[model samples]
Target: MKRGVEEIVPGTPPKSEEEVIEARASFRKQYRFPPENNNLTAAQTRKVRLIYEIDITLSEQIDALSQLAKLNLAIRNILPPETWESVASIPDLSSQQVSLKVLDSLYAVRNNLSRSGELARRETRRTDRNLDLATRSYERAEKQRMDFEDRTGAEDSNSSIVTDRETAALASQAAEEKLALRRLQSRLAQAELALVDNKIERFQPFLADHRLRVIFSPEHVQEQIGAFSAKEADLEKSLLASQEQFDQLTPNAPVSTGLVAAEVTPGETVRQLAQSYGRDAAHARVSLNQSWINHLNIQRQFYGHRVDFYQNKIKRRQMSEITRELDLEIQRLESETDYLRNRMAQARQDAVRIGDQFAGTTGISPQLIQSLQDAAQEIVETLRMEALSTESTLSRLRNFNDELLNRTSGYTWHEIQAILGDRLPLAWNYQLFILNDRAFRVSTLFWVVFLVVIGFFFARYISRTAGSLLTSKAHLAPGVSAAYEKLVLYLLVVVICILIFNLFNFSLTSLTVVSGVLALAVGFGSQEVLKNFISGIILLIERPVHKGDLIEMDGRILKVESIGLRSTQVLDFDNSQKIVPNSLLLENVITNWTLSDNILRSTIPVGVAYGSPTRKTAEVLLEATRSTEGVLASPEPFALFSDFGDSALGFTIYFWTNTADRLKISSEARHRIAEALATENIAISFPQHDVHLDSLNPIRVELSRQS
Candidate 1:
């Protein structure tokens, strides 16, 4: 309550001039650096742990040297001089220059580690200074916050003394505002009643004096009616123009309402917001209409009575003045009514727009909608809490005001002091209110929903772009590209989800509960999808087959088209695409002809007629293979005489091709070999049968008897 220049800021501890200087001197005490302290710091702890290990290593080397010494002494007599000299070199090996140098280095390191704990302490001085700065800044901010609370009753007050003062000030202010607002209302009421014509008992005396009375002349009455009609017409025109401009308040109104609760202008007090309510003209007009509608009716009756009195009493003196006042009052009331209607319409329209925004139909995001909803709920709860808190505060304030107003009362100032010491009752429910809740402020749910939406598109774009780049520029195999692309996409998704979970303010214990529930619900249904997903990752990493690589699995020769997250697409020899689940690929044995390299080693088996020269047949087969297109010449095609068949000699040609599609190359090679064999007069043999008929003449005589 008392404001003045003191030794310290408000809400800070008071200190004398001498005490302040002493405090400064204490802070400035010169640091006498301690003598070389050997106490080990934290960083050396790891090195110190190796102490026993280093001792064991040294002990092992010592034992090895001792054994060598015994061996040298025992063999010295039997050995040749050169051999004895070699034995003497054992000591030299132990004392070699390189060995001494390494030992000296280790010794130096040990000494340094032992003596340099002081240096470690010196290195931490900067950290201590930084901590000191942080502490001082924290104290300063705390003092500032306390000062703010003392002056404004903003921060939660603990000390009864500070709480009492702040509560007393707030109570007094709320009372003062309520009183002024009420007084203003009373004065406005009197002004409206006076402005009305019906409450004219005081004016009846003047009218009762026959001399002051005005006569009702027919010509003047007719002119008054015409003038009043013209005024009404002008006022109607003004009201229409005012209604058109009434929407000016619409833009600023929504902005103020839409702001998040914590973002109010700094240093705002409860009193300031209360004062603004009366400043709104539309609100004031609406209040006046609702509170004094009866007065308005009375005013209407007064206007009628005065006009009737003028007509009856034949009054002539001040008839025009009374009529003019009635005309102005009627016009003002009509304009206010029209303006209020227009303002209400604008308010309704703005409400609808805000509602649409909240419902996510106005292109405003749901997070923004949630933020707006939270802000509004916080405001409502805050207002409700304040209302509950003010009931007791207001009651105490009114009692105090009444006590102050008493003259020669038994309630002395000592008793008043005693009464002020007692604090108002607590608003117990305010503590339970959600206005200051951290859950609303954390915006966890909003960000989770938002990140998930963004992560999906981001993962998709990266996967697609990676696949295209690897296939076109990097020239990776189709399956490899597909594998890598999908791999990166899935990894990105997992990383984002993990980061989102880690960033959540709420404990993941709750998330675990939710996830457990979901897992239980989805366990059976999602098993296949889960299996395929894991298998796809395996397929990508292991790369049993790449896209465009010919693979034979389960007796089907299929070429891999692409690898996906759940399924791998392949093309049959008939050029039809087949989607095979990734699980199938991992479960079955797949023969990837070109997984490692593109060159496929093709083997073709051919047969030649029996009794044909084996050397000639082998030479013919080799020449045919060499003539085949798409076959590598550097490997030197070789023909293996595999077996001697019943009717022919079988030979197999082995060769390699650079062509990726081995099927095409194999077919072309077959065509080339056929032409080459025919040109060389080495006919390809087929299974044949020859019958010997040396004893068949007796069977023909038996067949003629049956005829």
Candidate 2:
């Protein structure tokens, strides 16, 4: 069947009566769209299905959970002051558990209020519709009554017929609807209040504890540790130096019988008795120094150990939690301190043995030798005591940790979860997807970009396949082959970009509005990128610069290796890769040596001593160019008398060669030219200055190099 307007042939008017009849008869339907049924009935309102789809499929539930996880992370990151980051003090598990139970009640109340709010909304809608129907019924009845009275005379019409009982019923119905709406709205208001108040009440205790901890917590235990460590280091260094000096003293050497320590047996002038003792006097002096150093070591060890005690206190700051990690750390410290104690005992035994040897050989007083040995023994003893005390402290800390863990472990799992703060429980932290919280909600755009990247690499594979086919089956220069592949890839990119832009610009919105904003953004945000793209397009089309062309820009010569969409990679003389923006080559004055053709003219300036024949030198230089490789034979090499320098006549040798690395080829030709010149007895020269001296003014001389 033909639909009327759709089947009507374009530009075909009904030229006859029969055609008009046929057209009229064939008026058939082309489309039937869905019907609008927006009005909800009372039954539907009463049975309001939950808007949140709790009975979703497993996959959909997982998706919802994933979104909730993202929301949780965003809340954690953006609301740190409200979370554990701002928590100053941790409350006991029991206290925290009590607060959490209260919070659970509050959540239950909130959920109930939420359900009631939905019910009240439905009731309001039902009552509103009832009121509308009643108003319409009243108007219709009034109209009928009025028309009935107009037929008869108004004076003869009965009050019961015109002003019927329906009027009072309509008024009562409207009043009832108004009262029901008010009651529902009032209940909703109270629910909202009760929900908010319960939330504040539940969280008040945690916030109060956090605030107190933040205010009163120790801030810089690290600084105090540093100060105590400095004193400890000074005392340790002094003790080590004393031990070294004591060990270095020679045993069995002469005691000093001089003014040193003033113990020379009341000598006739204290220095004269020391001369008599000879080596004995020197040994006596060393013994006195060793004894004094040992006395200082004992004092140093006592104070240093005290500093160590204070440092241990500093290290123990803010670790009140009984975590598995703390237990491991305490055990590690215990083993290390035990090892330190054994090392200290070994050092003390060596010191005691040396002290006894000095007392026996040098015949020093037993008391003085005993002092040295006692100081060493005392330091080792102090270290051992400190080690024992640390071990005891560690044991106590472990007991404390065990007790706390047991207390927390006695609670229900959910209660323990409360003490761990508000991270999502392990059950819900599924790594279904990685999150970039900065653009949390716009993850779809990120997916699009990620997919586009995969597509971009796929596009490259296609380009490379096409390129490889060309290289294997067809003969093309490397440069042309590369250009072909890049051209195909760039075309794909341009098409894809346009398609993506149009998809956004024209779908679900006005094309003109989106295009205007897009144009403005591109113009302002990526104008340079756009310029480079356009410049690259021009270079590709114009062929003024092609891959493998040797060109110079900004006084540096580089060979074009690859032409990208926005930039070109070039290899310089040193074979170093340099990336130049497409716009840079297009906009600047670049010299393209291999642009027009690969045949290029190269010049090498030459100079011979002032007396050398310019023409002969030219012949020699030109002849040398003939033997050099890569030089064009058709356009034969030529030389010219170019300049007259201070002491040399300069000549220029010119040659045409197929383009190559400019420096390499030019260097070869120049070497040949110099050899040709040397063989001809024409010398390449340096500039020389002549001086004339006047006897009276004697060439004013500086002692530096003179010509």
Candidate 3:
């Protein structure tokens, strides 16, 4: 028992004798010992004495009792004393309970330690993953920053080189300008000398001609000048009279004086009298003779009393010489003006050429130079802003690159190559890094042009295919067959073009953004063009009217010719073609005669005297329509007694004709009706009214008074 208690406590020693005695008495009621024959035997006492010695206390009895007491106290502390006695009644509880309590404490401690270890392992793994991802992100960012820095540095170098070249070119241009100014001064001096020489050479000849004209044949010159002036005056008067007659005469009126004279002549045939006028007898004699007579009469009435006819003739002759001299002087002045104009034009061209050269040397655009300098100022401002932005970005990139280089200084080129192998070819990696150090503008331009060429060819192919498809007329409704086919082809081409753009790596999202901006610009810039495009699409889809339909739009009756993307062409009633914007047709109301069906009804109205039978007239008109070649027979021609006028009965001949032959059928039918009416002895009415008057009582009263 002592050994068992020792096992529970492990290395703990036994308690004192006084404590044992008290313990035995306290535990006696709660604890039980093994049953014997009624009392303790000598062997059991000896065994108890041996257990007490092994327990290592001052008195064996006291030690055994103290151990029992300690066990009782332990039990009472753990459980109620009443339950403890029941629990301890079972054998070996002191040892078993102590062992179980030790095991429970050990298991609790082990579980806590294991949980702590697991938490530490998870935290380590999480930390390692975070560090790795951060390292990769930092490395990628560093590479991008280095690339940007290298590009910026190269651009700065190029800009500096361009500036140096521009400065040198400007200096050269200044020198050239100075030399050109000196040459212009020398040429002006030479021109002044040449003008003086020319004046001296021409002066003597001019004086000689003036002297001869004044001295020799003065009277003859005067007579010739007077005769020429009189003839010119007569011609002017005739011309004025002819113009006045033309203005006063109607288009259908007689135009010749000779024709009028023939009409008035007695016992002369009209043809013979007319032939006596001129070879162009019909035109010369028809109406102009009357005009000439009226003009002569007006002149005699207005100016005959003021001057003698012969004296007036002499005055006009003198005026002719003066007019001739004045004309000569005017001609000379005009020649001089023409020469001056040509010289001025040449000077302007020279100035323009010089200005263009100056612009080229200075790397300035001529249009910008001519824009009053405002554009140049704006360009300079823009450049300054761009430079500042570029400089700031370059500095940031440089700083980032420096940080990257410091962090990765220990890494080898092979290590970088390995990391970036997936993105770039292994052989090209070194080349790419070296090329990144200088300007890569040439390579960028080459790629840009390559992409543009690809896009251009793709667009061309789509446009050609679409144009061919639209022009074909295979698949469409009967009413809008031609137009619908064309529209489908056009839409397909556009869709294919958009798909080709997508194939070239252009995203719909980016295209949408660009289209939105362009739409805003177009809305503000060209509203009419936008309206036409939208209207054209609507017209193609709705097909309210179509090609070949007879329609009237904007008061113009025409046959639809062609419907294009932007405009519609129509042939008018007069056979003239007009191109109308699609927007106008879509927005305005139009009359379509053959939209639904090709058969059209045309009406021809005729009036006969009221004495004629209305039924007979209707029958004659219908017979006339039936005989017409283009009139339709299935619907059968008919006529109606439409109305009764004051002098005549109005009848309308109704006939059906194909829309294409509507005009021809109407015209022919009218002609046939006129012939039929003539055969029937029915007279056509004219606009005529008769008035009757009566005199009442006055005549009879006057006669009675006279008798």
Clashes of each: 9, 8, 12
Candidate 2: C-alpha RMSD to true structure equals: 47.4
What are the per-residue Cα lDDT tens digits for candidate 2 across 1-707?
11121122233321233432342233211111121226844333222221111112222323433443343343233332234322323233224222322322333343444455566456546655664665665566456645655666556656553333333333343343333333333333333333333334444554444322221112333444454466556656655665565456445434442123444332222223223222332333343334334433433333233233223321222223324545665677578567757866774775665454454444355555555455555555555655654554454344335434543434445445564565434323434432322222244455557756876887788888877887788976566667778777877766666666454442423346667888899999989999999988777766677788889788887889889879999998887999899998878899988766778888888778988887777778877888888777888888889888877898887888777655577999888887787888877899778897558665666677778
lDDT of each residue in 519-610, candidate 3, tens digit only? 89998998888888788878878887788888877676788887877888899888899999999897789989888888988888898986
Worst 10 residues of 3 by lDDT: 302-311
lDDT winner: 2
**Arranged by TM-score, best first:** 2, 1, 3
TM-scores, all models, native as reference: 0.35, 0.36, 0.34
Which is the winner by TM-score between candidate 2 and candidate 3? Answer: 2
> What lDDT score goes with residue 438 in model 3?
38
Query: Residues 1-707, candidate 1, lDDT per residue (tens digit)?
Result: 11122211123322333543443344234211121226854333322333323333333333433443343333232332223232234332233122222222332332333334344344335444544554554455455545655665655455654444433433333333233333322322322222222212222232223212334445654675575566556645644554444434342332233433565541231222222321243333333333233333433344344446434431323344544554554455455545545655554554455555345344445554544444334333333333333332333222222222331234435445555564322221123312223343334445677998799789989998999999999998777887788788888898878777666644456567678978986796788988998898788898886777878888887888888879989998888899999998888787887778767688999888887777877787787777767778977779889998988889898988874656677888788878877887878899998997787457544435555
Better of 1 and 2 by TM-score: 2
Model 1 segments more than 4 A misplaced:
1-451, 463-478, 498-507, 693-697, 702-707
lDDT against the true structure, per candidate, is 0.53, 0.54, 0.51
Candidate 1 TM-score to native: 0.35
State how far residue 394 of model 3 sits from its true place (Å): 64
Lowest lDDT sum, 10 consecutive residues, model 2, at: 49-58
